[model samples]
Target: MKKMLYFFLLILVALGLAAGVGMWKVHRLADSPLLIRDETIFTLKPGTGRLALGEQLYNEKIINRPRVFQWLLKIEPGLSHFKAGTYRLTPDMSVRAMMTLLASGKEAQFPLRLVEGMRVSDWLEQLRAAPYIKHTLKDDSYRTLASALGLTGPEQVEGWFYPDTWLYTANTTDVALMKRAHQRMVKAVDAVWKDRMDNLPYKDQQQLVTMASIIEKETAVAGERDLVSSVFINRLRIGMRLQTDPTVIYGMGEHYRGNITRKDLETPTPYNTYVIDGLPPGAIAIPSPASLDAAAHPAKSNWLYFVADGKGGHTFSTNLNDHNKAVRSYIQVLKDKDAQ
Candidate 1:
């Protein structure tokens, strides 16, 4: 009876040792590196079971051992609780690390940049071309999209969306993204309008946005924005026509190629600042917040005209004669460059 008891005790010890080895092997497999050389994007779909995930990873060549991955999932409680979403995988990532990332629900985000000074049509094209965005707009018309967004005016959607790098995940709708951008723009406009400088020429918030858009298109230089705003504000104060060329280009619509002619400037359109007495009917492009602020508080200058200098900036003038001289100088600079 004592011998039988000793044999049973020895068997128990061997079984215990085997169990420890099995646990160590499973843990090592869990920490094994994934089979990849470069950064990769891994998408785990919803309703995918753990067993299926292991098999999928094996089939995609992201993992070498499907059985071990399945075993790891079964052994580790955290690995079994991963959610469905897109995840970025690096070559240095271990299988355990990948599982932890999915469990954390940190999905990859993509960026859509709505650049400043671009028209609504350009923004629409940008939206349609962006990957992983769900397109829901029935038609990309100004009036239709405006109605969809609950806006009630002709071309009301123009310049309503803010220009920024909007981040979104997979399957995010385009209209949803646009709504977020519009909300941000509304907040920015309201803030600028509330604290606007007193006695300005703007009749309403819309006019302010219109002026801001013009300011955005007038110059890309940071120092020139407020100065450009001053020129337009002074023009509006003196009942002078805001003969800006950007407005004329916007008025030309699809007819504008790479250049503008004197006839094009002479033609009358609602957006033609050369012909229109005051501000245009609506915004020409989406304006940056800096441009909006510049429009609200123009620089304290008597400047009435501006012409582009050769060095990516504008030369401001307070009189038509000085503006003509600046234009002549700009032309001479161009001629010199051509001669060179």
Candidate 2:
């Protein structure tokens, strides 16, 4: 009887120890702090199984241990949940909380900013530089990609994309971004072109975009957009050459050395407004929405000439004499600044 009692006591003690270990594991999984001290993006890629994921989380220090999680994933009825996404995880969260968050599927996002008046090449460089975005353009050829975008104006891809802050996931590709920006531009143009001023000289919406791009490159001041648009409009209405420097520079292409040479203006390129009678063959740069709106509805003004004022704005003139005087004054201002 003594030996039996001793054996019974041993069994009871062993059972109690096992139960205690189980409770400790449950408590740790339920309330313990995560190994990561702050919020981080934990990407669970596609085809990541539960056991493999647990091991990865453990290796990444996202969790203190993976045994409890692995066991729960195997045994818990109606709790088998996992997803593939870039998850924003925090250290204050428990294992159960993390599991809940993963199940929720509210993935993290990234941002791409396309600024107005930027060159397409510069924009592509930015897309290539972003590490998070997937690169789909293996050829790195803008012309081929532009053709794929189904662009209409100029039969080229220079000023086709809308400028805005676009947010997306890590899976977003360069081609996808290009498609979205181009679509946005198309939508904006279609919406604004419907209510355009009557009897406009532009042949179609593409010509309007071309004009807007010129206006965008002309002025950095938002308030001056309409006035600048009017100057271009008046010039076009009277059969005068644009002679805008930006277009000449764009025509120079790789040869442009920060300034337009006399030969560059004299040599003919389709983009050279001086050489071309009307709007350039296509947009010189990407235009903003305000500029596009200004192109559709230019302010009522007969003023055809403008010269840069001493300030960061332009002085508009209707007559040749006044424009020459303004140009002289601008040159003098520059000389005075240089003499100083």
Candidate 3:
């Protein structure tokens, strides 16, 4: 009976050793990399319980087994408080690292690429259209929008907002987005003003904003802004009309179709650069930082004219003779292309 008791004790000891080894293997696996090689955008929805989340992790191939994760969650204290938000997750992350990331509550951000050179109306349309944004702009009118945003002094809402691919959280509001963009523009303009070149045609920062808007509309090419800015500055200095077609289009408001007309150019409005002696009463579009800088510190050039080169860019000239030659070449290029 003593020998039988010793045999049973040996069996129990062997079983205990086997169980310990098995548990050690499970712990190692919990710290190991997952099967997938790439990172992905993962969303942990609100009200997700541990079981559901473990299953989700398994389904996404983020973990080897849902049961193992579920078992771990049952033992982990204070880690049950997982955050609910979009996350950029990698399968290579260990189970422990994943849990820590989820628990920390830092969500991945999305971008709203408000392009450079869009008008206030275009910016407004984008603001209202974002699914993630909660819009509070009560009306589309300039007066209504200005009042709602607490913007003082200007009835017009043209170039106050900065253009950028603004990063945002899920709960970002449209009004908040606009306000931030406006503040950025203000800061940028002020910074540029302090470092402005000697004897710029702008009487104030707003005029510089107006000039920058013109420069933004004139060119999207990186190298062309300085030349275009110089031309406008020279024109402004010599009491020459800007004669830019964008001003005419802006003046037309909603009446502007796909194309401009001679009558449209002839018809005078506050934004018609051809009729207006200097910068318009306000900006026509949201200008970029580079364009703003270019306007504030125009290139030292005698260039007074530029025209579209019938390609993606413009042909700049220091004199009317060269400008007319460029214009004729541009027209001929268009005619030749049409014939082909």
Candidate 4:
């Protein structure tokens, strides 16, 4: 009976050693790098289970040891609770690292770059074209989109949404992204308006945004923004008609066919600064932060006019005579270019 007891003890010892070695191998496999040459995107759908994940990884050749992966998950059940989303897997990532990333629920972020000075319609086209964004807006109309974004009291939705590179996860709704941009715009406008230089002609934040939008459309030059802002502010202070070409173009809308004619400029629209007094009804396009700052704190000058210098900037003048001279020079430059 003593000898029988010893034999059973020996069998139990062998089984314990075997189990320890198996567990060690499973851990080693988890630490090993995945079989990939480049970055791979792993999309795990909703309701995906650990067993299915292991099998798919093996089938896709991302992991060589499906059995070991399964063993690791079984041993550590916490690794099995990965969320459903698209994960970016790199060649240098180990099985354990990948599992940790999946479990952490850090999905890959896609960028949608919305440029400043573009109309809302232009941005809508980009939003619709961007991949992985869920289209939930009832229609592409400005009123519909504005209502969906919970925008109130704005007659027009042209410049309500801020323009920036917005990052989002897969299946994020369009309205959700737009809301983030709009909220950012609200905060930016409020911050700038609060600290704005006193005695500015702006009656409210809406008029401030309108001036900023005009500044954005007037100049792309970083140095020229404050100067452009001064011109419009001076005009507003003196009660002079803005007569800006961009406002005329915006007023024409789809009727504007590339270039504006004399008749088009004479035609009155709500946004036509030539016909409107003080400020326009609303913002014409999304304004950049720099433009907003320029509008809030214009350069201390008596400048009332600016015409594009044949170069990629504008020449500012305090009088209509100098402005007309600058405009003539600009016309001459265009004529020279045409002649060339």
lDDT, each prediction = 0.90, 0.85, 0.84, 0.89
Tell me the tens digit of each residue's lDDT in model 1 across 1-340. Answer: 9999999999999999988887777788778888999988889999999888988899888988787677788788877899999888998998899999989999889999999999888998999999888999987888767876788864678788899999998888988898898889999999999999999988888999999999999898998899999999998888999999999999999999979899998999999988889999999999999999999999999999899898799898987899999999999999999999
lDDT of 3: 0.84
TM-score of 4: 0.88
Off by over 4 Å in 2: 1-21, 37-39, 72-79, 91-94, 152-156, 336-340
RMSD of 4: 3.0
The reply for model 4, stretches above 4 Å from the true place, is 1-28, 153-156, 335-340
Candidate 2: Cα lDDT at 162: 93
TM-score of each: 0.93, 0.89, 0.81, 0.88
Off by over 4 Å in 1: 1-21
Best by TM-score: 1
Query: Which lDDT value does model 4 have at 195?
Result: 95
The per-candidate count of clashes, in order, stands at 0, 0, 0, 0
When 1 and 3 are scored with TM-score, the better candidate is: 1
Error of 3 at 198 (Å): 2.8
Clashes by residue pair, model 1: none
Candidate 2 RMSD to the real structure: 2.6
Best by lDDT, which number?
Answer: 1
Q: Model 1 clash tally?
A: 0
Worst 10 residues of 2 by lDDT: 71-80
How does residue 92 of candidate 2 score in lDDT?
84
Residue 18 in model 3: shift from native, Å? 8.9
Q: Which of the two, 2 or 4, has more TM-score?
A: 2
* Candidate 3 C-alpha lDDT tens digits along 29-95: 6688766688777789999988889888888877776765665666674566789987767867877
